[model samples]
Every structure is written in structure tokens, then in C-alpha cells.
Target: MANSRVFLAGLCLVLSAAILVYPSRAVTAAPNSAQPKLVDKDAQESIDKGLKYLANTQRPDGQWYPSGSYGTYPTVMTSLAGLALMAGGSTPESGPYAKNVRRAMHYILRVAEAEKDGLIAGA
Candidate 1:
């Protein structure tokens, strides 16, 4: 129960950060001017690399770190990682990290389906 609360808090923080750092307003801005100023080239590259690492590290079952330090919070990690990919402009339907997004979504859905309740479990 306590773990779930902590996970919820952390997930909320991540979601809030994502919204602020990657606002929808930036998407409509001129790519040649406003967009470039919001994030630098190197920072963007680093983000790309990190997303790629996350994608590569995903389990064949569509989860990440399912039995390690993050094992206790599979749903939280998956949600946060998926949000990060989305914040970087990738969706399950399109974009560079589409596969990752889709995989995470599928995993989450599977977990939800297996559970009697709507809430996802941490373990």
C-alpha cells in the first residue's frame, strides 16, 4: 500500500514535469525558430539516446526492469517511460519511438486485463 502511494506520487511528478517541459504550445511553434530555442541540439540528442536505451532495454514481455531495483514498480516505470517517449513527440501510432510506446501500452493493458480491478499492480 505504501509502495503504491510512493509510486503514484512519483508518477504524478513525472507527468507534471513532462507537461511543463514539453508543452503543447511548443508543437505549434515555427520549427525553424521557436522550437530550436526551446531545446538545444545536444540536449535533444541526449534525450534521443536515453529513449533508445529504454526501448532497447524493454523486456520481450513489454516490461522494463521487472525483477530488479524497479521490479516492485513495473507499472510506474512503464507509465513514466512511455510518457517520456510521448513527450519527445513519439506516439504508439507514429514517430521514432512508436515501437516502444506501443510495447509499453500493450504491457499495461495486459496487466490491467489480468487484474479484476482497473488499477495496475506494482508487483
Candidate 2:
């Protein structure tokens, strides 16, 4: 129980730090500039592609990178991926990737429930 609290507290701290360090909008050329428009389009495209990849790779169990080295850290990877989805403006309640977000949440909750210790440790 204590470990779980510590882990969750740490996760919250890291997330808070991330939000403080990275603004939603990237620093780019002036909005009226053609270069900035192109840059924004390219960035959006890259983000779309990345999100699509993540959505496609998600397991039925809602975990990601469930094999190889990453398999050792399923909870961490899942949380990070979920955070990425959220950073992209998707939430469990709404957004383009809402379903994915919910799945991740459910998976995490299930894991937490199954474990006597509340800690979300890697399998």
C-alpha cells in the first residue's frame, strides 16, 4: 500500500513536471508565416501517424509493447503511452483516442485490483 502511494505520487510529480516544462503549443514561426503553417502541418501529420501506430499496436488487454524488453515494464509503458495519448488531447471521456485511453485506464485498474499490494509494478 505504501509502495503504491509512493509510485502514484511519483507519477503525479513527473506528470506535473512534464506539463510545466512543455507547453501545448510549440514555439514556431509567426502564425501568419507560411513556414509556420507548413511546420504545424508536418507536426500534426507526425502526431497523427504516431497515434495511429499506438492505437494499432494496443493489445486486447490494453497494454502496449507487451513483448521483449518492454514486457518487463508493462505498467510503466502503459502509463507512459496513456500519458502520451492525454498529452495529445485524448482522454477517457472524450477525444479521438478516447477508447484507447479508457482501455488503458481499465487495464491499469484491473491490474491494481488484482494485486494485493496497490503498487502498479512491472510484471
Q: All candidates' lDDT scores?
A: 0.71, 0.72
Best by TM-score: 1
Residues 1-123, candidate 1: write the lDDT tens digits: 545644564456446545645579746554564343756889889998998888888887777865676337887788788888787777676788878877887777667656655467544
Over 1-123, each residue of candidate 2 has an lDDT whose tens digit, in order, gives: 756654675566446535644656765334563443443777998988998888888888998855786237777778888887877777676788889877887777777766677656644
Model 1: how far residue 36 lies from native, Å:
8.9
Task: Please list the residue runs of candidate 2 whose C-alpha ends up more than 4 Å from where it truly belongs after superposition.
Answer: 1-39
User: By summed lDDT, which 10 consecutive residues of candidate 2 come out lowest?
Assistant: 28-37
For model 1, the run of ten residues with the poorest summed lDDT: 27-36
Per-model TM-score versus the true fold:
0.66, 0.66
The lDDT of model 1 is 0.71
Q: Candidate 1: TM-score?
A: 0.66
